[model samples]
Target: MTLTLTQTAAEAVKQIVARVPQAEDGGVRIRDTGAPSGFELSVAPDPEPQDTIVVTDGARVFLDEVAAASLEDRILDAELAQDGSVRFALGSQV
Candidate 1:
């Protein structure tokens, strides 16, 4: 299984990637951080060799091996605030 994203999440990622310097190949990246949620989100200029890449509406998401396995059955959603902050949520795939 692979990861998936809601349209809002995809757009948020696209906007983030667009603002980064020298990030033509960049996208949002997710990794397991051993925290309670075990997830860490960030932007990467490129995917690592072992990443799972998911693209939607031209937006890209890079998932590390651990995160890929964990999120494979989930969907990503996002909310963008007027202050330019983004909140991401994960839900079980319907």
Candidate 2:
């Protein structure tokens, strides 16, 4: 199983990565923070050697080892606030 991203989420990620000039070839990276959500999102110019890369609609998302396992059966969704903030949510893949 592998982590998946909704089209909305992909677009959101694409938008984020577009803002980072250095991350042109990069995208959004999801890491295991071991916190409440046990996850964090950031712009990564490149992926770690062990990272799991998932690309959807030309949007690339890098999932760290722990995050990859944790989200393998999950789907990532996103919502953009009026202020241009991105809110990400994880849901079971159906």
TM-score, one value per model: 0.93, 0.94
Q: Can you write out model 1's per-residue Cα lDDT over 22-64, one digit (the tens) per residue?
A: 8867998899996896688888999999999999999999999
What tens-digit string does per-residue lDDT give for candidate 2 at 4-55?
A: 8899999999999999999998989999998995788899999999999999
Give the RMSD in angstroms, all C-alphas superposed, for model 1: 1.1
Best by TM-score: 2
| Model 1 poorest 10 in a row by lDDT | 34-43
Give the per-residue Cα lDDT of candidate 2 at 83: 88
The global C-alpha lDDT for each of the candidates, from Candidate 1 onward, is 0.90, 0.92
Clashing pairs in 2: none
